[model samples]
Target: MTINRLISGALSITAALSLGFAGATVATFTAAAPAEAASTAGGQITRSEVLARAQFWVDDHVQYNLTRRSNTLHNDVEGAHKYGPDCSGLVSMAWHITANAGKGGNSTDDFESWSGKEYLGSLHDLKPGDAILKSGHMELFAGWKVPSDHGQGAWTYSLNGGPDPDGDGWQDDWAKGPTPNWKGKRGDETWSGLQAYRPIRYKNIVDDPPPQSPPAPVYQTLGDFDGDGKKDIAGIAGDGLWIHRNTSTPGNFSTSGVFISNGWRTVNKFMAGDFDNDGKDDILGMNYGDELMIWRSTSDANSFSFQAYKSLGTTWGNMNKVMPLADYDGDGKLDFAGIADDGLWIHRNTSTPGNFSTSGVFVSNGWRTVTRFINTDFDGDGKADIIGFNGGDELMMWRSTSTATTFSFEPYKSLGPTWSYMNKLLPLADYDGDGKKDISGIADDGLWIHRNTSTPGNFSTNGVFISNGWRTVSKFIGADFDGDGKDDIIGFNGGDELMIWRSTSDANTFSFAPYKSLGTSWGNFGYKILTSAPTD
Candidate 1:
């Protein structure tokens, strides 16, 4: 069939077929459009408008704190709250400032003290002046400015800067005391950090905005959606999969997409794996109908198009996710696995896209099904193994050596303690950048990181990350979210948004900032995170 026919067929099958391409909606860098009349009052706020509103707020509320330590701001934009501007406070202030712009400063109580619900879908479609998510804090998306070196890049309104006569320009660090040209260089006037300037609605603003649309967040809600060198914020809006065209200017983004299939409606959870056997990455989404959906991106990033999806008809009720793909079968092709209420389904792909001729299904063997699915070369035979957690408190294993077929269901490796239910599992590469892959998981009691032993599939709990202080580690994903090379963790809190914990000098040790609210309320389950490779 022709490509157009294929796409139309896919769309008709189910909305499960996304615009194609991994997270295609997030197109980076578009030439600034001419400021137009609000075509649709309170219509779908365009990106530029979002950025402008955010910038307005940051220009007003941004303040500096000379007494605060620079490290606080360096580590987290919101870290300076005790001394000065903080991430959450910055967002709160942005709304207050924008609504009360001409009326002098507004009192804190003029708006709610930020229960974390203010910035849900609005943020997912961020523009300049919006907030950039920091590990534990937030940074305001200053307008798109000409970078000192790169000509044009995303500049932030931050605390701790010298005055810019240009009104809303960047400020370099002060080698000496505050400089003379500083616009508002007073203890109370000068802002150490310029927070994001978004046009959020204050309590009684005349043009009070209506409830925001449901966020079409492509980035994993529990993972670093935007690859901003930091896992600071969970996705606010749009899908996480974005394409960056490295032209003279930053690049442009698109909401339209290609190559999607049906069966998405039934699929609720997904995992990224290279299924086309082309060495590039592919994805598997498990839907509500217990079906598995496969999506493929172009090999050449520069000229790639929207995603191409294929439905491998496997039904698992109450399906939650398709785990990160691994080459369980030693065949050169990438192996795929999924989880559903019924059990697990593994697909061994052919060298071609959407072809799953080599596949297998493992029903939940009497034991209550598990929620987590991960791949590891458990048996040192060069081939990888599959690991899963069962509701019956079992750590099940499926090991294989050759890339010929799906892994055989091996015996369960009982990691004692019915109490030690595996909530989430992540693969942490050796901190020193060694080739070994370590395993980390969050349980009810706390977090655990296992050092991979020589034997495949076996890990030693030599190190651990914290799980004790948290109320419920809502959603957690293991990824190099901050681009630090070391694997970091992003988790949803008992509250609305998320928190990121960075690893310290020691592999197992971590340092945390405050939680960032993604606008989703607490107890809302089924959120996840998916990290993507940066565009070339």
Candidate 2:
């Protein structure tokens, strides 16, 4: 059939298919008009506007032909109404550039170097109006959708034309098809070769205003500090205890006032947990003398006052790298795990809050070279496992052979390399709810999540989760701050601005909502930020 008939047939089928879908709307194709310049003169066009322009063609009977190159004919522009535009032509027209000037009728490779556009490294950097180009092919990224019940990553939506597989001239469809989840080669198609680009505007458009700052500095450890049932933030700076209370929003914290301030300073490292098992989170820190101190929360989840203070001892002086808080012994009390000059040790909670056994040494020789570690149940065996980097970038897991005071570790299982540069690692709760704990790491590129493909010691290397500009993140922590069952990414930008990215994927993947800035100067409060869920 002719290209025009094919596109019309496709639209008819689409409209018919969408009838029962409540919110679905079918595009009404019209005759092609003269090519016109974009509505606004020169400033950067918003993603929405870009999509709108592209949709105009989809709604028009614009036949797509790979070999037939033509510019948009909606306005009184040169080369208007000449030939049916192809995939690249559609993008060029939407971007308001000549087919030869990099916006439309040029080769896919030419668009990559088009003067008016900037190359984006990953698909994660795509905005609605961006273009996704690969060898011999190109498409307009039309944003993404989080399926109502799909336990997977967000599905990418796009607009494009092609060498119609069925010998049909060209079929126009709004939801063209699903793109590959990753950036690399996909089957015969080199999806990894896909490049995204944003058009550089030359018009006088009012730029988007700067992001508003949160009321308070969103400094570290966003846990429940005041005994309230919401996740909060806590940071220490120059003897000042800064707390930002949560204001009911998922990533938002109260900016109205500092939740609490105390005469605590020079805290080199700190963590938060219900050390006392009193059902409320508390703070633990180490000072200049390597002395361990505990600040018991005396107030509700909204505020904090010192209920008790205790110096665990000077033994922590030589120890560093305090692991994440966990109940290692299956006891109801929280314990402190860390690496010391001698080896790995755990300050076993002597069934008392803020108190530990005088002798807290566990596996000695095997831990000296361990760089990063998290105590979690990797196999769902109910016993805590030690997963970490063994100084050489090797990912190794030490399954708990025993959880008693004298814990034993099984022979380390190797999970491969590329783990050395990770600055932060955490055990992500069963993201897919598959009863297996997933792992998340923040490296120079961005946040990466390795879905547990197999129990105990297997992970998928397809972690294209968060990439692009995430290299500048200075600090980050993972927690289901919104009580969504899936862990979220909360971190500080290089400027110490707090940002929270909510999880949208339901499987062993990581796709987050755009980060909402909580505020800045959070890093200035201290290098450590603690995050935890609300306590009863």
Candidate 3:
């Protein structure tokens, strides 16, 4: 017996076989793509439409080898209709998940963060619209080859051409085939024969069964990517993003960053804050269209992730410098402070978790005079305070004193001519292991560290210097990259080199080990949109 096929570029394959890779069109296929999947609330898609979408590729003979190594080939690129032309791309499209910033398709890692996706532990639990997945592969489950044969085999549709009769390892499928779901795992995003293929069903994939539970998210601090209670270094290049997990030991990170998702670089600007007070940090994205969308963090034990973004607001066409702050007005929801319209504005989060709140002016006439400002608790008043340097290089502290929506501020203290030497402020953390908020910044020659004294305004006694030759580092993000409870600094040169200045300090002595190289080819795409992740 022989099977004839149409491949890309009209290539025809004439192969003689007994039960080869090719099979009849799936039984569930509907001739017309149904509208049911496209109109569901909460972005849900129906099971039949998922099948119809998957069948379109098989019918149209999508080769499935274009795994988005290049932006042009990926659905993220504008007008990429192939839906990424890869296994994950096919799933991303068939499942109706958007690529977000890229405007195309989701990568495999993105499934972790997206809300409404559920994991089916074994083959017996899978349904027609369910996906069989590991780290690097995915298959649209059709049904059992035999109703009782699930223990041995089941039917599936996949891209990334397969049919490894030689039994070596995974390769692009010569054509989309009825690749049987197998037992095993693809630990490092690679799968050979039956390597741990588990099942995942989208929470909103309907017409089959109701989900067992709602999506539960793992929470982390603003800078923590993996939700391990330790902040990690994360960033994006092109459509891809990586999370460098902190090993809990100072200066140690997982050599290979855990891939979190794709299409991150598409966000115009990112902000880090938990709008829902979930303890886990959620993301706020500003796109080129001046629209603000929020992607609630949904990280799991495996990777850093977020739920699909929902519209928060729009018309933010002019924010020169913006930082998302949690409850600056003690409103219990997210708020943001930024320098815009020649003044400082406080945009409050909406009463509901999913929409934009109102915006109010915090300082109509004084923000321009402050050369630089940072949000911290310098006065230890149990509320976030503002620390900024005035035109006279006067480092001033404004204690947040308010009992209502109209919060007021008073000049708590000032250390004249102290902060002028430090050109930039690091993230507010206890850098000296003193349990008190300290301040650090970058200067012309190197980095400076100042301790918080018992008194306000006079933060330190002339502080101390950590390193000298920091003239070339372009980006500095102070975070607890290691879970050691002390903050460390990560620096990136103008090029690809990423180095970390691990803190080696106690109560008062300021010190850090020499910069240790994290890796190269970091900001190759000229993107500083990440924390140094992109969530910030």
Candidate 4:
């Protein structure tokens, strides 16, 4: 896919580190596009096209993965290869179908195996018959959907990411509006909320590569998620630390709860990246006690185990914001970084839990209401830096030096115009990969990915993805949803379902392809989805 050029010198070290995938080697890959023309869409994607693609695939692969596609969530009967349709499995089936639409072959065998790195790049380029993934499964970007209002419209996709991700006809409670409430309460009873739609245009179609070859088993751990023998994954839902198992014929999963809070039932955030040189992926979760809980995998992949070591105490500081993991220290181990209501806090790894120390903290010195946060080094120094928002016009930055314990200064990095408090930033590797880190932020207006080409303490902007009338673009997370190595944006609309936006022109800039409803619409209330790759 075409991507905006990221200036090498201007990017901050933290920003650059954030873009580095923990394990993937950084290849000198480059795209042929300038900063300004990244998000230009040649046409729109439609809902009908997505449905047709999903249906076609499911119809063809009515074996193995899609063998038993009933409209229920029960156990598989004897000899039923694909009994129940869960969220990811369904999407897996759908991607298999869409990948080999016309070519004659077993749908499951024809589709490529999932690859977190390769898929991100392919889907972001917007290939005609590509798939976007949520986790183990995937969804197709049927096409773009341009409504009467040019920017305000739902994306269309073949197969949803929820129960019937493979478009096997099975649906979930969320797919139906007025989804069951937390208290078993029903809110809305509408079916239209989860239906797919279609767009009119498609752009930047690329040749589909042969499916990715699965990586060798690096760590043969027992509680392997994806059953790949590698214990590189860590996840959290509403619960504590868990491992996903994809080996079981319908895929089995298990939770360790090693990092769970003692009394805290609700979990706010969960992420995994190699936090230490330990090889095994470390797990972190935020609890109700304003505590930051950590679990380290001490041994190789197979012998997975943990003990709660670090806790951002109630007295110390509570972190409720999204926590991003990266090796900011350049030590090859990912560090824990995030923002809270009061200030920015980072826990650098000592490689040992309980002994984990704070990187630095920038309080709400001048600006109040520090809610959301992002970690990036705006300047091209080899230190991890921080960026975030407050209830003010200016954005905040805390720049760290090579050996500094705390960041220097520059509270408000002016964005010129007033910014809606709900702005979200998705910082990818040098969209230019010029050794500098580039960033993409989202707001009510549209998407903006810019290359910081100036020196430290200076401010600049580059516009990549921009649309004026995007109605309720919920804060989204960037992941290679379609299994392409290129990062795609997954946003739940003001409605119940989540929309998949694939970058047609650039790695950061994307066009809207309304995906199937995530499942049943839970409620019209706000929901946040953080995508973590789970291998199979």
lDDT of 3 by residue, 1-536 (tens): 00111222221222121223244322222223342224322367677556655555554555445435444243311123436667777777667665442534666777656665788766678877788777866777755544443433555667655554544343434224342222211111122333478779987787834545421111113355444566555556677766666664655654457676787766766655556655556666777666777777777557678788877567665666664363555445556666775776767555454333555556554676675556654654445566666776787777766544575677546766756776666655566765556777778878787777744423443467777887777766666566565666776776788877777888758777777787787775354434412243
Model 1 scores worst on lDDT over the 10 consecutive residues at 248-257
TM-score for each of the candidates: 0.42, 0.53, 0.52, 0.42
Candidates in order have lDDT scores of 0.40, 0.54, 0.57, 0.38
lDDT of 3: 0.57
Ranking by lDDT: 3, 2, 1, 4
Give the TM-score (vs. native) of candidate 1.
Answer: 0.42
Candidate 1 lDDT, 380-464, residue by residue in tens: 5556565656655655666554435335655566544442454655443333223345566666557666655546655333455
So what's the TM-score on candidate 4?
0.42
Q: Is candidate 1 or candidate 2 better by TM-score?
A: 2
Highest lDDT scorer: 3
For model 2, what is the error of residue 387's alpha carbon versus the real structure, in angstroms, after optimal superposition? 1.8
List CA RMSD, all candidates. 23.4, 20.3, 23.0, 25.1
Better of 1 and 4 by lDDT: 1
What's the residue-level lDDT of 379 in candidate 1?
43
